[model samples]
Target: MENAKSMEYWLQESALICEFMVFGALAAAIFVAVKFERFWSRGRGKREDYVYDNVLWRPCWRALHPAGLMAYRAIVFLFMAVVLAFDLHNGGIHIYYFYTEWTFTLVIIYFGLATLISAKGCRQLAKNDSIRNQDVRANFLKTDLEQEAHVTESPGKNLDGDSVKLQSHQEREEQKKRAGFWGYAMQIIFQTCAGAVMMTDIVFWFIIVPFLTNEHFRLNPLMGSMHSVNALFLVIDAALNSMSFPWFRGAYFVLWTALYVVFQWILHACGLTWWPYPFLELSTPWAPLWYFGLAIVCLVCYTIFTFLIKAKEKNFPKWFPYAYQRLH
Candidate 1:
């Protein structure tokens, strides 16, 4: 009895420590964000102007300077390396005693492949940005030369021909639309994968496993390991989602998460019977309160993360595109 009580005490203490660490990290993130934002809003210096006339090299320089682009790439690579190393160290192959080993292996492989593919795509995007910038500069120069020639032909004539000006404006509008569309698509893809991962882990851990096992069934060692891995993935997803915001503007992700939580809560409240997950059966006196508190904490963490990314962009003006300059 004494040993059992001691073990329970240690678990409670560990839980409390974990909670403190999470909240502390969130607080620090928020503090950093606020300080950075204040510093930027003060306008300490003028933004460095990049001459767009250099057709070949200007894009390359600009692409390299963006706030989170390079940092994100480095972070993802390092994270993947660490995960791969850990997996190798654990064994050539680790199996879950409870869940199917195939399922566990599939998830790891899927994410690993995804990280590799995304890294390649980001490099390509950087290259494409450079090429696109060169094209735009070349076109602008050609347009200027044509306008000057027309004016020189009739010295008294205005250089701004209505037809030419209208055409140029239309072209600019089209470019803007294209960029926006691409940004939206990227955000959708990123958020969908993130949400899927989260929902899958939640259901797999809290619902499926519990429902499948009897009370006497021992908790799967693999399930705990998987949960830890998923948590780390969540952190990565959060960081990436934050970075992807520079390219896209949408509320769909937030809406989807909210709707998902609501659906889960409603199902639980209806007593439809899901699993042994704490949230599903709030027979514990403080379970509902604890869950609601956790939701609020998540919201605050998200807000802080968003602010930090935005603040970083503000501090480094060159990191963002012209379209974002005004907003920042």
Candidate 2:
């Protein structure tokens, strides 16, 4: 009976593998077909000094009003946190032992960081307000003022009220420049978290959950939706934020997966009895094939998201009358 059950389990796993492989290959083909040249070349193919473009979009992403963006971040942060709490409640804190939970948690941290940074950037301004240009100009002004200070050769130049006010402005500008560290950190975190979120959630929903039905692992409705919810939260965040999804940062996605795989291997070396997903088990002779297949899936996942964001930029103006046209 034990041997018969083992045979049945392997049969079910085989069926799941075939189903996911066929579907994934077809979907990847369709996704790549949207912009064939980009995939062939791994990018838009313009040579540049940086691996990724400095400006995510042409006119700059900061054009989006910070107040709206802040509110969006807060909402996303709250929603994901609540869902995460619910998931933990259902499965116990041991849930974090899984990559899906950890990746989703990383996204929550991304939003938490985003909310705080946006609030700082907004500076009690209204929804339509953004000080991006003002801040940039202030930095330039501060630089000029410092240069002038070094060049001042007069023994004592008597300053008027205007000079005092200008000096005060320069001081504030320097402070503003110092506060910009969070904003830069926010950009890198956002880019890395976006790809990681998509990869984790997509694989769970499309591939892992389906096979787990027959295994000891079982996905309830909420668990099933967790993947989709994670994706939805990040996609909405991207749409509303002033950030662009740069394709070259796909390196981050690769790094994120490598870290997870390494973690699993470590667990296995320490005598863990099983793998989280069937394909991840390195004990089999076909382990390399499974690894290569999953790598292809990861590329496809990133490509699909890249297309989605670019499509939003390309089509938003056509669909929405006023605000969409002003997004960038």
The per-model lDDT (C-alpha) reads 0.41, 0.61
Candidate 2 similarity to native, TM-score: 0.63
Candidate 2 wrongly placed segments (more than 4 Å): 1-65, 124-180, 318-321, 325-328
Q: Name the 10 consecutive residues with the lowest summed lDDT in model 2.
A: 49-58
Residue pairs clashing in model 2 are none
- Predicted candidate 2: what Cα RMSD to the true structure? 11.0
Candidate 1 has what TM-score?
Answer: 0.35
For residues 188-299, could you state the per-residue lDDT of candidate 1 as single tens digits?
A: 4443334334444555565556675565234556445654564355454443332333211123333433444444444444543443334422334454455555455444
TM-scores of the models, in the order given: 0.35, 0.63
**Best candidate per lDDT, number?**
2
